[model samples]
Target: MTLEARLAALAAAGQTITYGKLARDLGLRMEELTNALERLMEEDAAAGRPFRAAVLRQRLSPEGLPAPGFFLKAAILGRPAQDPLAFTRAERHALLPFPNIPG
Candidate 1:
């Protein structure tokens, strides 16, 4: 399945995936995955959809959150994530019609 499809499924199931695992699953390098995620973020934003990439997390994330770069990319895309937790929470909530994931 595509990255977005995978993410959508995970989000619908109230689950999250680590960046490393996702990269390995897609047979992509870390950099490539990050690049793809950033592009996805931009596309989602432009389409007025929540970031499907929000279902991604860092391996050692403190709150099951994505790496700091996720926020940085969001900022670059004109969505400044001053509060990372809050931002990610909202994104995940809006990503799917029925969001079962908690912040």
Candidate 2:
């Protein structure tokens, strides 16, 4: 399957993946994978669509402590959208820090 198809399939299967794992699976160097992902993001942005890949973050520790550093839990293609505000809200939320989270 093509790289994008493989990524979509993994997402459909509800499998969480990271850049390292994806690179290994696709037989690409880490830099190559990064470039590919960036290209996808750029294309989506240019098309005025939601990012093709979603980045999920999670605490490193079970106690939800921030000391261990956050990690990328998943990267998946976004679903078709009928509402543009949904994407705007998500982007706004991500860029603007909330009161609870430290900047």
Candidate 3:
């Protein structure tokens, strides 16, 4: 399946997939999958999609150290990652429909 299709599928499934999982799903390398994500994000913006690029951070436990499953706690459409807590729920909602995001 195409990268767009892959991301759309995950969103439809309401899954919080990791990079390795995404790579496995597409039968691509980690770097390639990461690139696809970037491309999808660009396409999302170019298509005038309101959803911006962001990472999904679902806490594994109620407490303890951060998990290593995801790349970062939070990130936006631009560079320089930021913590998810800094973003409001509404802002995160704005990024919900973008590539590789679950509904």
Per TM-score, the best of the predicted structures is 1
For each candidate in turn, the TM-score is 0.89, 0.50, 0.52
Please write out the lDDT profile of model 1 over residues 1-103, one tens digit for every residue: 7887788788887679999999899889999989889899999889978888989988887898888888888888888888899998988887766556444
Give each prediction's root-mean-square deviation over alpha carbons: 2.6, 11.8, 6.5
lDDT value for candidate 1? 0.86
Off by over 4 Å in 2: 55-103
Candidate 3: tens digits of C-alpha lDDT, residues 14-82? 444545555677799967766666666566556755322233333453322223322231234442235
Clashes per model (N, Cα, C within 3 A): 0, 0, 0
Global lDDT of model 2: 0.46
Off by over 4 Å in 3: 50-103
> In candidate 1, how many Å is residue 21 off?
0.4
Task: Kindly list the per-residue Cα lDDT of model 2 for residues 1-103, writing each as its tens digit.
Answer: 5567765564445343565666778898967766676676667656764443443212243332211111121122343334433542353344332423654
